[model samples]
Target: MAERDTTGAEGAGTEAPPDRKRMRSAARLGAVQALYQMEMTGATLKGAEVEFESRWLGAEIEGEQYHAADVKFFRRLLRAAVDRQAEIDQLTDAALVERWPLGRIDPTLRALFRAAGAELLALPTPPKVAINEFVEVAKAFFDAGKEARFVNGVLDHVARAAKPAAFPA
Candidate 1:
């Protein structure tokens, strides 16, 4: 995987444990994968939760190490994203080109928007922080590709709408 935690931007308060950061990062990635899996496989939210929660999350696999994810956070992001996917998609849809609606976007990008939207819309963290984190997640999957820039722009636009109070005059 990609080294995603060294962007030099910290969250709302003091730094979390090194382990905590790793786990949250991992959970973000896993949440994207779970959401993608759900869309592609037609799996229910509960089914995706069970599959990811049981077999992966913290498990080391294919000789790679996985930090133990923040299970509660993972569950919350997954569940909340599923519950408000329509809203998330609507918000993301507003940010995309009229000809390239959310439905026309890549499945992975769709999942990224939904997963990041869940947090950006509801989580207590700063919007910039959420944007940065998701940008990193995008980088992890896209490897500095064009998708990463698209993710940044669309998400930043969504954040301005989702949490206008978080922005300044």
Candidate 2:
């Protein structure tokens, strides 16, 4: 369900390269933020999706442009995350330690994991791809903090569990 935009806003003139795969990556990041918003504000799934489409997509904050995301992928991530939050959370809990459960994690990181878990569970992309994308998203938020490593580990664990065939014996 990937769509291509010939608008060239993604690459512009120079500097940033064309978004061959980055659009989906952007969608993942955006979906995580949208999911976080829903979690914190108790927003409905449809409401969150609309807000993203109307206000955030292609909208700017400063001077820089926001990358055009894969809207279909975003919807998939958000919908799957919303529908399977409890199951995803249970997997996250299982991946965590006894004391430091998912609730103790930062809310944003929790949202990131939830979106990542949804993608992993949905089977659209390879688990490694989804895990790597979320890990990069973690680094973007925390700048190589412990959270990034935590995300990598937990995501790898979840991926291994959810798609065991992806991992070798």
Candidate 3:
């Protein structure tokens, strides 16, 4: 797994346990995967949330163990993404280059944007923190550094727009 922490405690020298940091990161990634599954399978929010919460949050599969996620944060992300999808999509579209509308992007990327957008829009989490968390999530899903950079750029745009004061002039 990636060595980065999404809980903003990296390099802090014991501000929080590594396991706690990893859990939040896992929540962000889980939210993205749940969102993608919902889109691809037309799963209802409740159904998908239940499935992820009960079966996948910390389950082992194929000899690989998934970290336990912050269940509340995961639910918040999933609900916000679905509850505010239209706005999220619009924000994502505005952030992307004109040639690459939100719909035209990879489905995984679209899910990533929506999850990040939800935090940027509705959560009190710092915009930069949210961006960094989701960028790391992108890295987990993709092998190439290119996708991570793309995630960072788009999320920066969304963050600036969603919380302008957080980014000072």
lDDT of 3 by residue, 74-110 (tens): 8888999999999999988998889989889999999
In candidate 2, stretches whose alpha carbon ends up further than 4 angstroms from where it belongs are 1-20
Over the stretch 1-169, how does candidate 1's per-residue lDDT look in tens digits? Answer: 8766443324677676787777778788889999999999999999999999998888889998777888877887888799888888889999999999998988998999999999887566678777877888998888657888899899999999899987886
Q: Would you list the clashing residue pairs of candidate 2?
A: none
Worst 10 residues of 3 by lDDT: 7-16
Off by over 4 Å in 3: 1-17
- Give residue 51's lDDT in candidate 3 (0 to 100): 96
Which numbered prediction scores highest in TM-score against the true structure? 3
Q: What is the C-alpha lDDT of each candidate?
A: 0.84, 0.83, 0.87
TM per model?
Answer: 0.89, 0.86, 0.89
Best by lDDT: 3
> Sort by lDDT, best first: what order?
3, 1, 2
Cα deviation in Å at residue 156, candidate 3?
Answer: 0.3
Off by over 4 Å in 1: 1-13
Task: Using TM-score, rank the candidates from best to worst.
Answer: 3, 1, 2
Residue-pair clashes, model 1: 0
